[model samples]
Target: MSAVSPRPSYAAVLRIPHARRTFAAALTARLSYGVVPIAVMLCVTRATGSYAVAGVVLAVFGATVVFLSPYRAALVDRYGPRRVLLPMALLYAVLLCTLTVAGRHPGASGLLLGVIAAVTGACAPPLGPTMRTVWRELAEDRLLLQRAYSLDGVAEELLFVTGPLLVGVLVGFTAPAVGVVLGAMLMGVGTPAFVMSPAVGAMRGSGGVRKGRRASLRPGRELLPPIVVAGGVGLSLSAVDLLVVAFAGQRRLGDDTVAWVLAALSAGSAVGGLLNGAVDWRTPARVRLPFLAAGLGVTLGVAGLAPGVVTLTGAAACAGLFVAPALTTAYLIADEAAPAGFRTQAGAWVNTSVNAGSSAGAATMGLLVERLPLGVCFLVAGGVSVGAAVIAGI
Candidate 1:
């Protein structure tokens, strides 16, 4: 008689010795990323008393973070996270504190703030990619690895949502600089805890630096599909935010109504992420990725045709369903394609693609909304995603 294989579960992923501890510590550090953005923006705005300066400062920060991400990840790959992460986190935390102190007084120099923000961005640790690399090491079984990625993705989504809300609550009582200080504390405390984990300790003995130095820096052709699809997914999702706002405005709905619609999108993504992880699919991840991207594209296109807010919310929810699964699959593919000693950098490329695409999408959609019909803008955004999928398939 054939033996029945154990079904892969999230509990099983955590049950792997050290996984729970390591993941928890990583999440603690990652939460700082979610908190820092809004906190920094608010602090800058308060200091400069000009939204224009605040916007430029935030843009400089984001540009550095997004563009330098892969290089940061490469450092982790070469030096190993245990040896590298703590120092990076410390520098990052110190910079945040410095920024807080400098931006506390009104009429703070915008140029100085921009310089500090840029330096802070450059020093930001690649904790997310490093954690994903640790996950790859812990979950040797393919199915279990899928679950780990899905759970990580869902938790990350929640962190970003909660981080902004947390900042909102804190600013009601304290200054915005306090929120920035809070983020610094999280990073200062969390990185040491993460690096001390036994899982990370194991990596220290592997001589990743020597191996990483020998590995080619350029990503191979196999990585193209995931990277391209990830960029497309980011572009479409970013554009959806503006499109929804416009959709609400055209119908005379208030900003509160727009929140509810966006809430549906988040709800759908969380549910879809959980479901994607739970299933034991026969199809390979590479085979599954393009189809997932296409599903998102079609749903987003249909969202443009919604006659009412309710229908639009439903369409957005449908689009959200594909968001997590597609990105998760993209990460999985990138991991598979990565060379030995290069896993962190491989993951960072996918991450950088998503963020860079988001910046572009937001700018493009802003212009399109002024000149084109809302429905047409949606079509253009969706079409970008579909085109990416087609390119990946070919």
Candidate 2:
């Protein structure tokens, strides 16, 4: 009789040596990402006394962060996190402090704020991709690696949710700039602790791209499928927020109802991420990618046909069941496709695709929601994911 393989669990992933400490430190710094946006937005709005200026500032900030991610990740790949991440985090923290001080007083120049915000975004450390790189280093077993990524993804999801609520609590007690200060402190403290971890130290020697391996760092055909699928998933998911709001308004649902519907989508993604990790599948991640994307696309398309809020919520949950799984698979595919010494850059590209798609999706959906029927808008969004899956599968 063949011996049975043990079922993988989140516990096993955490049990890997240094995994707990490294992940904790990474999360501590990453939570700043969740906190900084809302805090900065409110701070800018208060100082400039114009939502329009605040909006433009944030747009500039986000554009730099999203579009420049791959280059930032390359720095990590070249110098390793120890040499690169600490300086980036320190510079990022200092910039945030400068912004906080400048924005503490009213009538701060919006143009100056925009310049600062743009530089700040550019300096934002690529912690997420770096942490994922560490996970790759720590978990050599494929099955265990899957669980690690899932846990990382799920925890990240919660951190973003929690970050905003934490800022909300901070604002109740003091100014939003206080929240920005807190974000700076988190990065200052957490990043040093993360780099000191033994696991990260292990990666130091493997920093530079080996000769003849430089070409592998470039986005090749193997990397394209995951990038395409990740972008599609992001594009589809981004529309849900606006679509849900429009859906609720059309049905006269309360704000709380809208919150619950959106919450359901998050809850489903969390559950799906865990289950996806737990399964011991025979199929490769690439084979699973298209199917997962299709599942999301199909469910979201059906969601458009729901007659009531409750039914719409159910459909949204079903569609969300595939979100984390698809992204996880995409990351897995990207990791596999990337050669040694370039994992961070490879992961960053996938991350970039998701953010870029999200930006496009939001702009596209905003236009569509104003002109087209909401149901038709949802179908259009779903079609994007399905179309991506088809292209990726080919």
Q: Output the worst ten-in-a-row residue range by lDDT, candidate 2.
A: 1-10
Where model 2 places Cα greater than 4 Å from the true spot, the runs are: 1-5, 205-216
Clashing pairs in 2: none
Candidate 1: regions farther than 4 A off: 1-6, 205-216
lDDT score at residue 317, model 2, on the 0-100 scale? 88
- Which TM-score value belongs to model 2? 0.96
Candidate 1 least-lDDT 10 residues: 204-213
lDDT of each: 0.89, 0.89
* lDDT of the structure predicted as candidate 1: 0.89
- Candidate 1 local lDDT, residue 326: 91
Model 2, 30-121: lDDT tens digits are 99989998999999999999999998998888899988999898888888889989999999999999999888799999999999989999
Summed backbone clashes in each candidate are: 0, 0
